[model samples]
Target: MKYKHKYSLTPIAIAALVAFPTAALADGPYVGVSGGVVLPEDSSNAGEFDADVPATPDFGAIPAGTEVGWETQFDTGFAISGQAGYAFENGFRLEAEVAYSEYDVDTHTGLTVGGANIDGADVAILTRGAADPANPTVGAVIADGQGKVTNFGLFGNVFYDINTGSAFKPYVGGGIGYQWVDVDYMPSGVAVGADEDGTFAYQLMAGASFEVSDNFEIFGQYTWRDSTEEAEIPLTLVPATLGVESSQSIISAGVRVGFGG
Candidate 1:
């Protein structure tokens, strides 16, 4: 008679089965650095000056009610960021990050003085006599500007990683923070500037990571950042202010190192 042998998991096999999942989903602290491109959306209503102001007695040949409109076109730029965070066994993480980026201006158009679109002649005239007491061209419109915009931000983020029981994991996250933005408009011989307050900033993120080792991984992500704030730009010799708003998007890749799970 052939006897049937009882089959069961060995002690080591049982221990391995119990510990595998926990080891795969290790909890630990991590730090990372990323760099990529910054693509900014249109900056609408960047600046506006009153088109209905009377010329001062001291200013010569300066017309009243000259409407000057300025809009900014942002070119793609570079972004770099660093972050530190702690991940939990349930695939949740919390982190703090700081990032910086710079974008070049594509064009600065829509300048009008006394209902007449400003041209190269107008700019030349204004440049020659803008500050001349004997020939003051105060409140003259100067357009077709170019410059760079720089942004620095700090954020607190929360994310959830989707574990797939493989080497690849996907994640979605969001963050809220503060950003400082500076806009510098250089119109050959004129200076018009605007600055954003240390205002509320927020972002949405989605990404995937590939585990190369037990404590190291690489990730790529897309982030949409919104950083609109009330901005005021004082006009030259005018009692009016211009308002601007800003927004941007980014894509990046980086490496993360985990410690002490």
Candidate 2:
């Protein structure tokens, strides 16, 4: 009886020492801010013109030896976001975040099939020469020329927590969302369209949280997202009426805040 009593007391003592501190460490309701570079993993724009379109302009053979080279490049920019969430004692929770990002692309094309290197902007100017109120064809023809492209979008996110333990918490989550896009073509100076079509966008996120002081903690996270957008081009200089589609993958890191348990 004495030995069994001592053994029961040993188990009770161990539980008292190990369980109390862990219960006391758990907290909730946090908010945080994070800013970083938005890197594009796979970004591309591709489109072709429709020669069958009535607005299609005529291009005659030009002199030989004209050199043309086409190039497209997008500039990197900064992104900042804010997050709020509730941290639980268990290894699970929920979070909401809002983020804003910008990407600017400049496109240049020089096509020299023969000796004639075609200038897309110059074609717009020439097509305008045949301008008349009765003949709106010139405007339509000029608008068909491919020019500059600018793209921007807004995003919202909600994620499920998978990590909540010890001093360092690790988690894995997935989110479904949408992006609003604005696409504009050159020469026309008008927005071809905004892709509010609500196409599906998804992300994979992984990060760790370091407990700063129960209610407060510093966290670092990385996310991978896949999305797509499109721009329209007039058929003036291009071989056909063209629509350019850009496929984008973005990776970003930032901190977040917590609240409510």
Identify the runs in model 2 with alpha carbons over 4 angstroms from their true place.
Answer: 1-29, 47-71, 106-166, 184-198, 228-253
lDDT of each: 0.71, 0.46
How many residue pairs clash in model 2?
A: 19
Candidate 1 Cα outliers beyond 4 Å, as residue runs = 1-25, 46-68, 112-144, 194-196, 235-239
List the lowest-lDDT window of 10 residues for candidate 1. Answer: 135-144
RMSD (Å) per prediction? 6.5, 10.3
Residues 1-261, model 1: lDDT tens digits: 999999999999997776554334347898999999999886764344454444444334443434455456778998999999999988899999998888887766555455555443434344333434353222233334467778889999999999888778999999999888776666544566644455678999999988766688899999998875644555553434565566888999999888845
Residue range 1-261, candidate 2, lDDT tens digits:
455544345887987656544432245666777766555432233444333223324334322222222334445545566766665656555556665555554433443233334443333323423324454333343234333333233344444444434556666766555644344444344333233223445566777666654455566677665554334444334343234444444445555544445
Each prediction's total of clashing residue pairs, residues at least 3 apart in sequence or on different chains, is 4, 19
TM-score of each: 0.73, 0.55
TM-score of 1: 0.73
What does the lDDT come to for candidate 2?
0.46
